[model samples]
Target chain A: MLKDFVKNIGYDDPLEIYLSKLEKLLGSEYGISKRAVSLLLLQEDEEIFELVKKNEGDKIGVISAIIREANSHYSNPLSYIISERRQGEASRITNSVMSVKEKGLFNFKETLSRLMMNPFIGGPILLAVMYYGLYKFVGNFGAGVLVDFIEKRIFDAHINPFMVDLVNRYLPYELLRDLLAGQYGIITLGARYAFAIILPIVATFFFAFAIIEDTGYLPRLAMLIDQLFKKIGLSGRAVIPLVLGLGCSTMATMVTRTLPTKRERIIATLLLSLAIPCSAQMGVILALLQNKPLGLLIWLGVIIGVFLFVGYLASKIMPGELPSFYMEIPPLRLPQLSNILRKTGSRLKWYLFEVLPLFIFASVLIWLGQITGVFGFLVKALEHPVRWIGLPAQSSVAFLFGFFRRDYGAAGLYDLKTAGLLSGNQLVVACVTLTLFLPCVAQLLMNIKERGIGVGIIMSTFILFFSFSVGYFVNLVLILSGINL
Target chain B: MRKIAIVGSPNVGKSVIFNNLTGTYADVSNYPGTTVEVYRGKCKIGGEEFEVIDTPGMYSLLPISEEEKVGRSILLAESPCVILHVVDAKNLARMLMMTLQLLEAGMPVILVLNIFDEAEGLGIDIDLDKLAKELNIPAVKTVGTTGAGMDILRGKIEEHVKRFC
Candidate 1:
């Protein structure tokens, strides 16, 4: 019935001309309306064109001519004209049925939502959120206080010693004892790191994230930062993955599927793997640079610079049109405390379950490497590049640990910083280098899962070289400038 | 078996309606693209069992992203008995264009004006019966999150299937 109404509206003349051209050029009986197919073809919609071109081989020329004739009738592109007509009809129909009631204003929520999207005010608001929610709350309170209570009071003071004694008593073999209770042992190191350090940091970060997300601040943040992002070949929507990358890069890489274009996804994935350090790394970096503002700034500058430079370069190198950005701006509301807590708890529970096994596996791998002397050999190989970046040979262990888990490298760095092995400048360089390092094992696997293995391997190799090279340059520049922190 | 596929852009209460219809868990969150995979369950309306498919959010039939592709594929292949184009009532103007696209594709679409409570609070009131007449398809206003107007929606769905099917 609707088709009859449309047919009676006299599109038949233009459509018939299109069909004849289609039949003449393609010579097939696909019977699909040529005008619609031609319009789709004009918009460079590949799938329909391929279908029509395959079926209507000889008549394709006629279809082209008909499309050309229709094109000539409008100054604007036919696709745009067609879509506008459809949209106009939609609006006309909607207008006829929908009415507006004059009511009291929702002025308060409107004003607050507006304030969040305003660049001038939103910038400072963002910083305040980051400072309190992330730095002070997550870093200082969760990582500092909770980690100290768990790692020192519970594990170091009690569990490690108890586990060592138990292993020595039960497992008489030296190898088994070392595997379970030594410095790199599964029980002593991995379990501790997973529960004591990573758990608290992740829990806090998720708590903060939930609050921010529930308030609908993220889309507003995206809108606020859209212009700055355009310079880096991304739009505001990319900010979702980037910010989530701070929580977990592996998850963020999966989320990059939301990006409209292949180019955008690759760019986002690359930026995520290189510049955006995950929550674990961020916590350790924050702790490492807690008192060193200069070091923090230098580290921040290097990562941001690499993120922009590489993103710009990737956008140029990748063969695709840049995607236009359009996203809905959601209204902001006061976050419910219970919702925030529940979300954070669930997320933290998920994170812990995922990371605990990996952490233990990493520790077992390290133990195996140590027993076989492969760990020493790999560290020796890493020493060359370590020296190139002016970092000590021992930092190779952290870099080695980094391949297994970013948080492990961060834990290594934290240990190093505590031992007074690295100076302020060295700490800055290490944090910058490690933060820009390849994502953890899970992220690597996820990248392979999302993008093919070849792409994943290529991405990892590029990140490894790029991160170290950037570190080398930063160190060189700092040395030349003689601004020793 | 008959099927009703709920389709729309993300975060427009499709999941809420799906849950209300099927009484299943779908992890309804306040974010978009959370429902990445299609979820299907049974809905019994008027002593008739219908399968309800909750698709990944999609902006249009012309897909640009993976999730949208998933949503579009479900529509094209499954050919549901009724396509519930669930859209945010507050953003009706922008969203109705997709409704137009769905109708143009000759799919059996029922326009669901979701989040109508919020839309009403924002001063918008939709005349559902009039909208049904204009679009030549069933139109229902719902606040899915709160289960408002759900009985009417079910009634409309049953009536639509009885007449059209």
Candidate 2:
């Protein structure tokens, strides 16, 4: 019944003629209808071709000849013609059974949805969303308020002193005592950062992300940004992973697989590695430049500049087909509180499980580095770049912490800021450099996993030099221009 | 156990429907491309157990992206006892293209008009029985988020599976 009806619905001219001929020729059972098989074969589906070749044997030659003849009948590809026919039939059928009531041409949600995709309006709406959702909520409330409450009121005032006292009094061995209570102790630095700095910031970011995600705003953002993205050799579809990269680049790297082409995937991965700072780092940077509006502006400008500059260069250097964009924009819906909370909870769980160990492990490694003098040596080596970037010698420790995770390094800078070690210019330069720094260890491994080991290493190496160079240039510009924040 | 596979374009609430059927959370989101892996859980239809598989989203039979490849492979390899072609009701005209492809493939398909609430809110009304008769398949309306119309969907799934498998 289905095949007979579909055949009657039919494509124009020779395609319909070719389909019947191929249907008769494809003798083997393909688990699907012969008509469907014929259409696929005509469209030159690689998988279906191999299947038909295995099943049809010598008869494939005749089928190929028929396909060639059909192609001659149409200027467009057979797949396009066939798909158009299917779309026409679908619409015809839908019109028969589905009806729409007369109403105001643009409903509230529909108008908002349209405005969300308009270039001028959408861009400003996006900034407002980022300003309120990210800067105010995540940065001010999460990183500034909640972090201060946890890091200072709880961890610094209470937990660290309690832990150090407990460890110092009970621990017998001098080396063990220092390892547990010293500068880079797991409880002192690692656990503190995980719970105090990273936790609040990530939670707030995820909450904001979940709300925006549920509102169906991201796809509209994708549509709005498509023209810009096409210039970078990525389609609007790349927005999903890029936006997600703000939440966490490691997960975003995995999401890049969703991009249609390998070239798009590689470019997206490289951008995520080099430019997109995860929520933790972004929040901390926001907190660092909270009072210094111009410093924050400079940091924002530099990061966006690097994102576009690197993406443009990569798209040019890498040889591949330019990406095409097609995305389904789901209707805008009110953010469901349950869904938002559950999403945030699940993501936070994933972050805690994936990242907490790394934070503590980094602390242990730092402790080891200190004991073995390797940490001191690395910090010393990093100090030269730190000087070049116009940051303090102590800032080298933050840069080293950055290698573990971008957020951890930002957290290190937060400590330095609290201690009043860095000037406004140094804070801006460090934030700019650290934001563009190599992705965290989790993302590093994820990049290697998603891209091959070779590409991942190349990307990391490129980002390493690029971030520092950008930092050096920013510092030089601030000096040369004689404009200090 | 026989299997029921939920397939659709991305972000059409396939995972939410799967969650509704299996009573398991599959990370439902408003955006597309969330379900990167196949999720399977158990449910009972007509007093007989069935494995419900939630696949990554696919637009058509011909695969393009990695997610679509995974989805297309599930259809080819698993040979599900019943295929629920879950579609967003609001964009039925566009989404029905995939439904036609699935039907043309000669698989046992139930056209699920998911997100029906949204469609109705958009002042759209679909004649379910007429649509079913036109396509020569059973049709059901469902609001995947609130689990509305799920009982009817479950009834249809049982009927489709019992008749086919």
| Stretches of candidate 2 exceeding 4 Å from the true structure | A1-17, A20-31, A54-59, A319-321, B44-48
Model 2 residue A456 lDDT? 90
What proportion of the real contacts between chains A and B does each prediction keep? 0.34, 0.60
Tens digits of per-residue lDDT for model 1, A1-485: 22421111123355445534543455443322333344456554666667777776676666566667767766877567656766777787778877888877558888877887888898898889988998899879887888889989999999999999999899989998888888888888888878887788888888888878767788888889898888777877899888989988987898888888777888898889988999888987888888787888888888888888888888778857656778876666566675567667767777878888888888888888988999889999999999899998889999998998888999888888878899877888899889988889899998888888988999999989988988899889999999888
TM-score of chain B of each: 0.97, 0.98
lDDT string, candidate 2, B1-165, tens digits:
788999999999999899899987787777899888899999977799999999999989988888888877777777787889999999999999999898878877888999999888879999999999989889999998899999999998877766667
lDDT of every model, 2 decimals:
0.80, 0.89
In terms of DockQ, the best-performing candidate is: 2
lDDT of 2 by residue, A1-485 (tens): 23332423567777778888998898877767788888888888888899899999999889888989998888999889889998999999999999999776657888999999999899899999999999999989998899999998999899999999999889988778767777888888889999998899999999999999899999999999999999989999999999989988888898888999999999999999988988989999999998899999888888888889889998999978988778888888898898888889989998999889998789889888888999999999999989988888999999999998999999999999999999988999999999989888888888888888999999899999989999999999999999878
**What local lDDT does model 1 show for residue A315?**
77
